[model samples]
Target: MKTTLATIALLVLVLGWTSEAIQVQENGLSFSLEAVKRLQEMFESRGTVQQNPRSRSSSSSMCEDPMLPQELLPLCKQRGASASLARLAMVPMDVCEICAFAACTGC
Candidate 1:
């Protein structure tokens, strides 16, 4: 009985950690994308090329293009609409400074 209880506790702990890791990864990506957007806008306003400094310009362009990557093509074939929709839904949102501040403050 004790062993069973311990197993259950371990499973719960694993699940919690998985969830937290996913959340943190998502948040970090969101924050990064937001920073990119802001930088792009700033550059555009100054008549400079608006590009992500961290990412390869060619790769970014390819991702934005209508044609999907060959590697992702197979996944799309296997999962179809569900996988595509999930990917779309998980696309990172722009990070807000106010949100970041609040998160840091534990608000």
Candidate 2:
């Protein structure tokens, strides 16, 4: 178990070579270079899940409309299909108002 942990630690530390070692307690806590080499086998193995391509659809989604029930929706989002049409119809008026405001302010 200690050898396995030491291997894992060595694999994780990229700068372990430049550091000087010290024994705070004794030789009871130490990592073996042989153990680290054994753990390197994992990095040589092939990847399985990463090789597959992502799935996609070409058809237009009917989910373009909101799927929330009426009771769960907020006031602005709880409108019927006709309300959407009314908002769409207001676009020309909104543009006209902006034009009028800009003209009056010489903006």
Candidate 3:
């Protein structure tokens, strides 16, 4: 009985650690090389807009909106950054503000 209890305890410990690791990985931000390339392309196309004064206003607006992607919710929750993709909604996006927003909301 004692041995059985020890085995069970070990299993529980392993499972708990595994679950925590999985949660951390899932909640973390992971971008593939392809995604980075795509983001660079998008930023390049909107280079001029980024330089324009109007761009700041638009970026601020998007930063203010609250319709973020579901995947990003966790990161946002951890970071405590709020705001939606309202203004720069026009330009192709790459940065995941949703995670920061989610972190903000969670906090």
In model 1, the worst 10-residue window by lDDT is 22-31
lDDT, residue 53, candidate 2: 15
Local accuracy of candidate 3 as per-residue lDDT tens digits, 1-107: 99999999999998776433321122345332233233334434546344552444443432333543344344444432222221122223223323232221211
- List candidate 1 stretches off by more than 4 Å: 23-107
User: Model 2, range 10-67, lDDT digits (tens) per residue?
Assistant: 8768446433121111112222222222222211232211232111110011113243
RMSD of each: 11.7, 28.0, 11.6
Worst window of 10 by summed lDDT in candidate 2 = 54-63
Tell me how far the alpha carbon of residue 84 in candidate 2 is from the true structure, in angstroms, after superposition. 57
Candidate maximizing TM-score = 3
Candidate 3 colliding pairs, count: 15
Error of 3 at 11 (Å): 0.2
Residue 61, candidate 3: alpha-carbon lDDT: 35
Once fitted onto the true fold, the runs of candidate 3 whose alpha carbons sit more than 4 angstroms away are 23-80, 83-107
Per-model TM-score, in order, reads: 0.25, 0.16, 0.27
Clashes of each: 0, 0, 15
